[model samples]
Target: MSQKGGKFTKEYEGKKTGRFTRNNEDRKNTRFTRSNEDRRSERFTKNNEDRKSERFTKNNEDRKSERFIKGHEGNEVNETRPVREDIVEGRNAVIETLKSDRTIEQIFVAKGNMEGSINKILGMAKDKGIVIKEVDRKKLDFLSETGAHQGVVAMITPFKYSSVEDILGLASEREEAPFIIILDELEDPHNLGSIIRTAELCGVHGVIIPKRRNVGVTSTVYKSSAGAVEHMKIAKVTNINIIIDKLKEQGVWVYGADIDGEEYCYNTNFGGPCALVIGSEGKGMSKLTKEKCDKLVKIPMVGKINSLNASVAGGIMMYEVLKSRIDKKMQ
Candidate 1:
């Protein structure tokens, strides 16, 4: 009975040891599964953070690019605005202004350009007590309207217009017949400037232009005139037709320059107190204005083009009148 009891006790002890080993193995498997799940959660969180960082970086780059483009456009706008019409640029223009009776506010010359005609300009400015400033080339470029400043720019007072009486009075003061150049809706500033220069040389008493439809004397005109605008007397009237009739009553012969004129300009009589009418660049004289003239005179042209430039045609007519007057004087 003692030997049987010992065997049973040993078997029971072996069974208890096996149960303990099984419980420890189950615990190890559960711990390993939990560690794997924790590692996966950590990796998922790290990936989400990295994606968010990438998106934020891209958004910041887009915003910076947008600001840069807007700033570039704004700079272009500031560069092109505010064109100045009161400034006269170019060396010849400034020299003529100095010789004229027109008041100059100031003169700006580009630095390192004091040679040749520049010295002459400085001497004249000193004589007139005009302010002379030496500025950077870029400043002169900014102030220039004609883009041909030639390193000099003059800021002068606005042009003062003359009246019809002033023009007639000038002729009277010179003890000569009235030699006038009347512009009919002349649109080109360069044309007007060239006409003024020629008229001044031709000893024209004054130039008559309508207040409307005609270009006012601007900087371009001043530049184109090469400063002849200073010597020429320009009268802006409301109605050129009315002035024509009044001149006729005063015994001034009005002549229209046209392609279909009755007589050639050279044959026509311009010896008396005369006013020549020049039309616009494209269209010739208006019908009513043409009718008001005492006679229509044409320039001889054999070219394929039917019309001449307004300034060129006007110059020829003016020279004819000047020649006629000279011939009469010689006689």
Candidate 2:
């Protein structure tokens, strides 16, 4: 490891046990220990322990240096993107949002309104893993879009609804049967949002809702979906019956949710190209829309309540269909 010069290279000197480093000015004329070959060989055996110590120290420092320098310099050049905000105001709106599967950025509660609705909103936000911020009434007023803060407000990302074609295309691309959810004039944002969230979790391709006589995608639905609306593909159409006809032509069998239907939800075979039509919160499916259904399915209830929450009913039917498909796949 010796260099072909007057002075020995740093590499050779490093191998020596205790050689003092020479200054640059004196390096050209530095002297070495006598009998260099014999001294080097003698020191080699004794230097084993020191060599291990030096190697460990050098390797550790190199690894530490590599962490911040190697394979990470390119990442440092990229800028961090900012998140978009969708503000939902009012106590009820904020509460319903926290209950949905939506990702809430933060909740601003007006000071001194934490008694009833505001208190419930705060609890729901905390339960849903949302960030809550306490602010003055003026702050709530400033963040409010509807001008009716009702002592609570929330900031969330906007909902993105998809197209019916995209939903069917997704099912086609996956080479699996299309499992779709169609809402027939649903009037409640909470129910729509909850149904969207449930559909997303249950592996449905997409959801379809009529553009009119339905509670359109709103902040309340976004929140009620607990944020699952973001991952779901929801399409708005002018007429759900037309869409049903189209889906049927594409080999999708339509199942309508009714209080008095021919097939019980649990007993029905929901294993192929299928669409489940959920009716409005107040009125079930419209007469024409119900007539468009290939088969009518009902939730069997022994309890006193004849009907369930629209979201709950949709969720039950969705899972039933999902279970049937999954069991078919297993077979």
Candidate 3:
């Protein structure tokens, strides 16, 4: 193109052209896109932080629940102490328990079912003065683990049997003349417990019971003994006669309680180290057990009831023996 002066001159423009303009535009576009990318990155970072915070909070809550549940095993959720349930049910089970020297916590019987074996149980319970509660059959059913509770259930303490040596050691530790009571094949835990309680009160040294064919200490016996089991030394032996022989060798005179005795209980000398043997509930004394006794004494009964309850008779005999010892000590 020609200039204003009609002279042949090169035309030049001051405005920027092609490549540089395009470069400037590209730079601006890159800046804008970078700004957008930065904003998106901030948003994504914020979102990730929020998710992490949520996960942390959830994890804390789960940990707390785990701790709470872990703290209570086989125990109440709110209870501070752990507790265990020991439930024994059934007629013969309960009966045999009562017969054995066991610590019974409580007895539950079905209401309105007090005949037959249940009656026998009640009689045994009464003789031992065990705590009995008559409840609905459903209660027994709920308490029954075996599902064969013949209208009765007993809550007993865990049994802890002692050796004969333990009893002798207790006597030796006391430094007093050993005054022991022996139960031969006595079945009722209540009777045994009652005897133990009375013996404790009377300051007896220890009590010996046969392990077989006899009630070893049970919860019912412990309860019936009125917690005297804690104070008294009880020894369980395989054979009652062997223990008797051992006692005799230790210079302890053994006396047997029988219906046919050579002398009355009052007349029998209960001085020095002596052991009194009480028989089972139904049978008085076994032939072998009777032979083990150094002497036989009887409790004079004037009542029409030919046989006395084992516990009652044993209690009477225990008092007599204790009284005889006291009288001799005084003299």
Candidate 4:
């Protein structure tokens, strides 16, 4: 491309002539000359291959110096953000977290106490694509969010969980029907806790919960589930109704647990591409969410109370679904 120029009132119709603006025009022409993609191509693909590589490496050395090798040779420096507030306390929680997807800034595995749990933690960290730094127990304590860094603490990027599509695709790869549980705005930390434990126990494929107005994994929630969170793929979605619709489109039945429903959970065939939707604490399933449900089933309360505790209700539903799958398998 030819140099771009300014308009002038003089001859040649397109000739640019000016005093101070000449410098500006010259500057624009220089920028265009430098901006040509052909120059970059030439630099990258020189007649001399070795020279091309050397030039490329030289130009990119600034980005290179800052990289920490988490096994890959030239992987991008893991663009980590601030440490999340969740990991500063429990030793086991820190170890389990290190096994997951969150990127680590630096790990402070306590100075001593380096045998059973500590060694395993180090091994897992190496396997799971993170850098580690051994430091004094005080350092771990200082970084502790709960002052319980347990001689092992890690500063990590915000936790990144799997997407609904990824989890569903994973389940579909297996031969049997994929069972998924959708939690609709469940608030109690303990409720979130037990649901994950029960879901994993029942071999339901994965768990999907809303990103907003829902319970998320915390220490209390994790403890309540008794370490089931590690085994489950928990996905957060912005629109539970839309996700339900999508699941239905994919031939997955969306069943909501409701008191005034046409069917009971167990009587319905759970041995299919199915997802059971459990409702929130106070109001139950949102009306819009309930409408998106393919079918609403109830868990028949035999007692004086109209409703079961949220976690208890979810566990019952999950077990019923699992029982149906097992029965189908036996047949």
TM-score of 1: 0.75
lDDT of 1 by residue, 85-142 (tens): 4677787878988998888999999999999999999999999999999998877766
Give the per-residue lDDT of model 3 (tens digit) for 1-331: 3455343222222233545677788998998899889999999999999999989889988886665455422223324322223555666557766787877778999999988889998899999989999998867655543345678888887656577677777778877778888888888766887888789888887788876788665544544665576567777777888778888889989888899989998887776788889889998899998988899989898988878888888788888878887887798
C-alpha root-mean-square deviation, candidate 3: 18.5
TM-score of 4: 0.61
TM-score-sorted candidate list, best first: 1, 4, 2, 3
Highest lDDT, which number?
1
Kindly list the per-residue Cα lDDT of model 2 for residues 1-331, writing each as its tens digit. 2345425655566645234434532453443433565678778866986899899999988886575343233323111212123777666556655666767888888777779777777777777777888888767644443345677777877755678899999998989899999988787666887898889889999989887787766655655665466567788888888889999999999999999899799999999889999888888889998899999999989998788989999999999999999999999
TM-scores of the models, in the given order?
0.75, 0.58, 0.54, 0.61
Ranked by lDDT from best down, the candidates are 1, 2, 3, 4
- Report residue 315 deviation for candidate 1 (angstroms): 0.4
**Worst-scoring 10-residue span by lDDT in model 3:** 7-16
Residue range with the least summed lDDT across 10 consecutive positions in model 4: 70-79
Q: Which is the better candidate, 1 or 4, if ranked by TM-score? A: 1
lDDT of 4 by residue, 1-331 (tens): 1233322234334333454477787888888777776687676666567786777887677455533322123213212322233543355665656665556676777666788777887888788756777787656544443344567766655445678887787787876677889988898776887888888888978899898988676554545565577678888899988898888888999998898888988798888788989988888999998889888999887888899888888888889888888888899
Give residue 212's error in model 3 in angstroms: 1.7
Off by over 4 Å in 2: 1-138, 141-160
Each model's lDDT comes to 0.87, 0.77, 0.75, 0.73
Of 2 and 3, the candidate ranking higher by lDDT: 2
